[model samples]
Target: MNNIVVKEDVNLPALPNTVLPAISELTAALGIPRDALASHEEIEYAWRDLPRELREIPSELRGELIARMCVAVSVGLFDGAMNYIWNAAILQLRQKIRNFSLAVVAQIQQNDFEEKHLRDLQDSRLLGLCLKLNIIDEDGFFFLDQCREVRNNFSAAHPTMGTVNDREFTTFLNRCVRYALADSSSPKGVEISAFISAIKGARFIDNQRQIWVQRLTSTHDAQRQLLVNMAHAVYCDSATAEPARLNAIDLCNGLSTAFTSSIKADLINTHCEYIAKGLEEKHTASLQFFERLGLLGLLDESEQHVIFSRAINRLWDVHNGMNNFHNEPPFAERLLELSHQGAVPETIQDSFVQTIVCCRIGNGYGVSNAAVCYYDELIKGFSPREVTDLILAAKDRTSNLGRRIAGVGSCKRNFKTVLNLIDTASVPNLVRADYDNFVR
Candidate 1:
């Protein structure tokens, strides 16, 4: 037997006005009876027959699927109608899955699946997976699986094992739309994603902020989690504008305290890592934000350790400025002071020590000397063993000190005296190298 093909532009032969076409003849030859072939406009009328609440589903949500389902329903092809309804349900499930895990979406886009694995995930398994992920509750899951069974048993895509009458098909279609396809019945719930994007891209005035804050807080935690997740994504997005980033930070601050303490700590950790890699503008904005958060007591000591260490590791870059700016900011000195106020993580201790040595031995008399006052405060944070490692990295980096080597000899002498004098018991015996050649 030859395979049947459904072409996009199908033209049916028109009979004379007096001719009567049998339903069986028309179906066998044209795949649908003349009376069953409804125009797209007529199918739209059938869509209106759905209840107002079911009709309220966003057209953007599986619009094509709904249109196909409507056309199938209009034509009295009840089996095909069930198949289209099942397809619509799957569309919603796939969308929710993408929003849940971007990595899974990437895998799908890359076609990173075995053929057997792909085959095993039938429509029933798709609904079951969504159920396990809490995308749909148990009742909805079981109801959808029943709908899938209907499609499999009687739909045109499968061999004709049974049939559903027109009234039965319409009721099944309505159930699918109401329970499985629509985003929500409540209007405010539908607006949460838009609200998140709005807060990120634009700043809100005082009155506007109050209105939105009220709406956001009134929503249950389940809905608010979506807002907070989207906010974090916007905050860390590199393509987000500088002003937008500041706006996102402000918005996240408002929502931060609402989250559990553990969630807030993780949130702070993520943004701190982003700010650490950003340029001077980001550094300034993020630093002030952290200071404000610290004052509010939202930022704990562990979070402070993460933030300050990241900032310290980038101090040299800020002092020299990026490729665009020539004049270095006072960030190096400011960051050096911050390091002393808290415990630096052991992971970053090596980088911190390297930064201090390079800055102290530099030839320039400007920013380099500005770093002198904090040397005592900074070195106290390290131990004797770390200091030994710091000296070695410094000697390797400054082996051929240029014109700066002259001043560096005195700088080294002063630093060693400070280290050896303070905490004399913990300090190792100073092995003095030649000041002109060795220390330089």
Candidate 2:
């Protein structure tokens, strides 16, 4: 048999004037009160609303079920019309599940989801499953669940508890079409098992990584966020293989642009959990995770201070060690990157300024040539407060920079070069005298 298709331009015919009166007369002849049937005014109002609401549904979706709904509405059977539209909505949701792949559903639910399970699910459970699988979003779930309740209590599919007025029926139709039938291209849910497996397996090549990233971007925001947390957890796991760790990092990096405040908060809370538990390894890994994602600015000032202090102290140690010139570039470059991330925490500003100055002014042997550029850039970018600290360091008498600048040699001349790199405008008024004296 050939299927009949409905066109979008096909208008639904209005109920004839005689229909409501005939229904009332027929009820009276059957020894039933006319009040049992809809009033003429109610039928008129409902018939007037049908055509406008039906226009919102797409042409492809206006199939036989929609035709049946129009026919029911034409006879003033508002309950039957509601039942028809509700059935159409449920069928569309079911088709979406089928297209989303039952195998993926089974993987996500962590159980076997065969055709039988899908077929046997009640309307409430079906809506719930769609929500869990991200076939519908939170708002869709909310309004559709209310539609289900209306269908259960007032639609003709069951014995009616109460009658719905023209306004209520129109609202029901609008919601069904707006939330369920209208959105035909809802995102398919990510299969959690497969995603975790991919991350835990061999390292992803460029194309493979791009494919996964696209899948993540196309999926719903909730799933993207959950996957982000999972990737972070995988990266921090002590026993995870190197390839897996890199895979997790790549996934998180890909989705980093979409991170909401909630996602960031969850990550910070997890990081704090590791710290509270005294899990040094995981804490360190979490710090690296934030740094690699360029999200260190999200951390609090005290945390930033600790991070900068450790990095500065490490660089200072390497500068004072043997073969300092050969070892200093990487450390200097790393500190430069960290400084680029955000303002230096006020607590670390003094040490931060002193270290850069001491490094720029070489020891007796001379500065690390490879690390000089990084030092110059850092000095040029210093805040006015940091410039104040720099001048103070040269006059402190006990500090290395103070003692070196007290004498006349390459060390003193390099300090002069460091002063030249600073922007003169950034010099605070209180320290202008000291800065000018150092320059002279």
**What are the models' TM-scores?**
0.36, 0.83
Q: Which 10 consecutive positions of candidate 2 have the poorest summed lDDT?
A: 2-11
The TM-score of predicted model 1 comes to 0.36
Candidate 1 residues 24-67, lDDT tens each? 46655977645454333444344445444335465565467666
Best model number under TM-score: 2
* Alpha-carbon runs more than 4 Å astray in model 1: 1-194, 204-220, 254-258, 261-314, 317-330, 333-348, 360-377, 383-385, 391-407, 413-440
Winning candidate number (lDDT): 2
Computed on alpha carbons, the lDDT of every model, listed in order, comes to: 0.55, 0.87
Count backbone overlaps in model 1. Answer: 1
* Residue 143 in model 2: lDDT: 94
